[model samples]
Target: MPAATRERAIEAAVELLGAQGVRALSHARVDARAGLPPGSSSNWFRTRRALLGGIVDWIAEKERADFDPAAMPVITHLDELIEGLCAMVELQSGPYAARTRARYALFVELAGDAELGEPLRRQRREFERWTERIVTAVGITDPVPATRAVMALADGLLLHRLTVDPDLEVRPTIERAIRALARS
Candidate 1:
């Protein structure tokens, strides 16, 4: 199969997973959603596991494209880090909301299936490492712990905003949290 076709199928799977959960993901469903010929997705991903892995790959690629640290400016202050993080939050809540939902859905869906959780774990570690880099660049003395704390804060805020408070303004809140963390 062509790489573009495979990518399209993966994108469709992500959309389906987000809109209808894991149960909605299937080769045929992905083919239909992607507007490809019948069995096209199956030709690329012969099993459900393969399909899920493809989705994970797609998510990782999208994230890397969205936030390339090499392309980012140097962070000189806590507020700068806050601004970058706030932009990230905004991205998740805006155009990438569906993908974010799909990711969390996969997390829940794979929670009991250790074999299928590898891709998610890899993606998460990538995120954590990137966060650590940012935290370190902000002059945090203990970046490892600070990175974990920042991740927890961001995750909690994202969950709250997505589930309980859709209108939550997170910039100020995240800025304050980062400032406190930087000082600690």
Candidate 2:
């Protein structure tokens, strides 16, 4: 029941994130959306930042958990990788898009805060691990630089999408970037 309440809070937060971004996320809003009494979120999560962190952890864990090495299809060509990423983008809409946008926003907000810096660094390292595997599977050696580039492109694309068109399909841009990376 406690877990259910926590998840409800996350769901509410994700919805608000999608509609209004992180600027509008608050315990009162989540409580109202989740149908819980005001201050219930405080019982589960102490601070607003803690709630944001929990939401980030929840989203990241779900995405990472779905990542199965054995299920990954073998890719020998760059187009295959592009196809794979497009599929991912297609599958990862709704709450995931909001979650992604919230993460990028939170990163900017917490970048200079010494308290949250280490956790953000750890999350970045985990993302690097996942990106490195993808870059390697794309048949690239020296995936570190390529991984960084892809990450930067992905971030840029997300920012663009969030700020411009929430309904934007970024797969084509990613496909073009993949071709460019292959040429380099």
User: Number of clashes in every candidate structure?
Assistant: 0, 0
TM-score of each: 0.89, 0.80
86-149 per-residue lDDT for model 2 (tens digits) = 6665454444677666666667767876665556567668767776887887777678888898
Tens digits of per-residue lDDT for model 1, 27-134: 888999999999999898889988887787788778887777788787777888898888877778677877988888888988887777777778789889988987
Task: Name the 10 consecutive residues with the lowest summed lDDT in model 2.
Answer: 86-95
Off by over 4 Å in 2: 68-71, 92-95, 114-120, 166-171
Candidate 2: deviation at residue 14, Å? Answer: 2.8
- The per-model lDDT (C-alpha) reads 0.84, 0.74
